[model samples]
Target: MPHVQPAAPAPAPPVAAVVVLAAGQGTRMRSSRPKVLHALGGRSMLGHVLAAAAPLGAGATVVVVGSGRDQVEQHLAQIAPTAVPVLQEEQLGSGHAAAVALAAVPDIEGAVLIVNGDSPLLTTRTLDALVAAHDAAGSVFTVLTAEVDDPTGLGRIVRDERGAPQAIIEERDATAEQRAIREVNAGVYVAAAGTLRRVLAGLATDNAQGEQYLTDALAPLVAAGAPTAAVVAEDPDDVLGCNDRRELAARRRTLNDRVLDELMRSGVTVVDPATTWVDVTVSVGPDAVLRPGTQLEGVTSIGAAAEVGPDTTLVDTEVGEGASVVRSHCLGAVIGPESTVGPFSYLRPGTRLAGDAKVGAFVEAKNVEVGEGSKVPHLSYVGDATIGRGANIGAATVFVNYDGVTKHRTTIGDHVRVGSDTMLVAPVTVGDGAYTAAGSVITSDVPPGAMAVARAPQRNVAGWVRRRRSGTPAAEAAAAAESRTAAPREDRSEPSRADSDS
Candidate 1:
């Protein structure tokens, strides 16, 4: 008979469900806001936790909510619409929370993964490994463990003589020897749904906290002769949880550093990672450069070869290929290819700049569309305006768009030149190839190729300054100029014909 190899065992079925416990009041955080709702890297802590688990392809996800239920549920709806939120109603222990979550998905079987909602640093990779280890060992329950420098307030993992996890002892109930253990339970677990359901029903509230502890389940399962295991995470930080503001800030820095490191590895240039922040939701194409003091947030994207910052913030904005934005604040805006914005500029919502357009130093634009090659350069406030291709809006130009009652629009046609110090009153149009004279306040439309000069003609009032202010420096200067003008001049002109003949 030909040699036959046994077929490889089939891969384990996908996780039946993922239960996230978020019922803590987080009194130590000292904020009315729910601790899980506190944000880092532009996403709520719950959001990050959910996001990390989303790739697991779990059949269903349930978040157990209690304090600030309304806000947490509302945010959950926004971030994970498909995930169900089950109210814990009471400040029970982790064991009860898991039971409530499981009840919400009664039909689920196979493995259930339980995670803490405040552990935003948890990675999908660690979860995957834990599940895989459980399936391979055929264990009825598995706990994720970590070896930290200080296991201060955490539950210690107690192992048998054979180096297999025998039970988990909470710090408050552990003896002095157990308290010295550095290997701590991370509070993340994978368990057979049926076994977990049975074990949770028998949990007792006889511990120091008088709450049903999830760690208690390990003992009964072990005693019942059911296989149990533990998986140590590769990076202990992956299981870190946030309880206070100081820890939250530390995690924020760690998460930001991770993001920047990934970006750099993927061909993005971060000149100063310490001063640069990018939300996980933001995308940057390869070769894009983010300089110091740059913050890209809220679904913002930067295209290839784009340069941003040296003190710039962009939110919900799109910066196109080869564009440059420096020292500006932009929100809900679009910067087209090869365009330039700032040194100091504010681009508000609905602002769009076409290719090669320029919004220079100290300029503020809102709800404006700048056409290709157009320039609104330096000291301008332009709002509700449409600037045509190749047009030039001179320095100190103001588009008077709001009249204290209603906003209005101003349109400038192709190649139009708006002079310095011009005020374009809204609801007006400048025709193609037109020019507005310097210092003009244009209220009416101008014909094509015509110059609209709205200012009054120059008028001289002789000796007015001297008469108006007789003793001031200006009056003295004016009197001196008047005397010089009034004094007779030596004859610099050629003599007349009669005088030459004489």
Candidate 2:
């Protein structure tokens, strides 16, 4: 038998964990919820943070939540169902939070990506680049660093004269010369698990706050002669942690712009991305024109060549190619290709439109299936109704599909011409090629090619108005008016000074 070489020790399984620091109260955020729980671009900030790490093949991803642990864990339950949840009740320093979160990481020989949970702008590609640069350089620890102009409150990146790793000095502890250096510490880092575990165990509280600091351990790693380096990130906001309300809003804008920028780069036309808000999982097709004030959210799919409006909101809706939705609100629906929705329309939940369907202005449709070439022109409400192909519905048409307590359904057949102001009562069906006259109230079913007219016949009286001016049409008006006044108890034959005035 050939030498099996002990099965090569099962390949070691590439273990990696992400320790997202989220235990801070984020006092500047000025909210009861933790800063990590703040929403940005739709989901919570920590939700985007976890997604940036979990997709990197992290064997174990840990999020350290504090301040609002219950709510944070509740949110984390949905975002990362399989990842381990760790609680830091003490609300210590960032390093201490990382240490507490690390307790759940299995003993392994891989990298631990440390990031702030409030950093919604962190990209998976940038994170992967940092990891690759670390592995390629054979370094045990790598920190993301950036050179900014101010570097006011940021931690300064301290390096020796030989350009080797020295330490990360906080603004308070930094010397005046070191403080002048523009390179600042970006809170994101990737380091070996063993080194991180050791450094975290050796951390001490000597600072003003008497809290165990993670920044204190960097000096030892550099002192131990381990290959420690700092990879400069292009954008400083990638490591930005939200501290206050204004910063949180700014971060939200940055993150939303980042997502929209990627969408535009991928060929989606955004008229004003600054005003539009899109979720992370929403897929917008190529050539999809997103106008100003457009909100595409909740796994919504916008097909190619579709035009969404200046004031449109689509949630969980799927729009087909060539569909045009102008100033409309469509939720939980599916619109077909070549369809035109209103300049002001409401497409409620469970609505489906086939190809070439036109849902006109001021129209509302719910739980309805409109077939190809169907037109619900204006001022209509088609609730719980199904209409076949080539159905031309005139203005002010309504499907009265409800009767106070029970909901009913109206079915209209193909090539049917329904006139204006027609009310089609529910639980009734119009056969194929049926016609409904204008201002008709339909209650019974109409046969194929038949016309249903349910309005009262017109009664015309000649010289009725002239007779009224002469007191005959006035007699007609008296019969219609609610206040007859008993004709003032006066004789109609007496014309007097009132007749001279007339």
Candidate 2: lDDT of 220? 86
Q: After TM-score superposition, what is the CA distance of residue 234 in candidate 2 from its true location, in Å?
A: 2.7
The residue-by-residue lDDT of candidate 1 on 1-502, one tens digit each, is: 9999999996655688999999899999999999999999989989988988888889899999999999999999998999999999988799999999999999999999999999988888999899999989999899999999999999999999988899999898899999999999999999999999999999999876778889999999988899999999999999999999999999999999989999999999999999999999999989999999999999999999999999999999999999999999999999999999998999999999999999999999999999999999999999999999999999999999999999999999999999999999999999999999999999999998999999998999977887888899999888888789999987848987777998
lDDT of 2 at 47: 86
lDDT to native, each model: 0.94, 0.86
Scanning candidate 1 in windows of ten residues, the lowest lDDT window is: 9-18
RMSD of each: 5.2, 6.9
Relative to the unseen true structure, what is the C-alpha lDDT of residue 282 in candidate 1, on a scale of 0 to 100? 95
Name the top lDDT candidate.
Answer: 1
User: Which digits, one per residue and each the tens of the lDDT, describe model 2 over residues 1-502?
Assistant: 8876655544432338888888788888778888888887767888888877766787778888778888888887887788677888886688888888777765756888889887887878778878888888888888888878789998998877877668888998888998899998888888898888889888888879888877776888888888988888877777777788888879878878888998899999999987898888799899999999999888899999998988999999999999999999999999999999998999999899999999999999999999999999889999998899999888999899889999999999999999999999988998899999999999999999999999999998855565556567576675556256544666768777988789
All candidates' TM-scores?
Answer: 0.93, 0.86
For each predicted model, how many residue pairs clash, with residues at least 3 apart or on different chains?
Answer: 0, 4
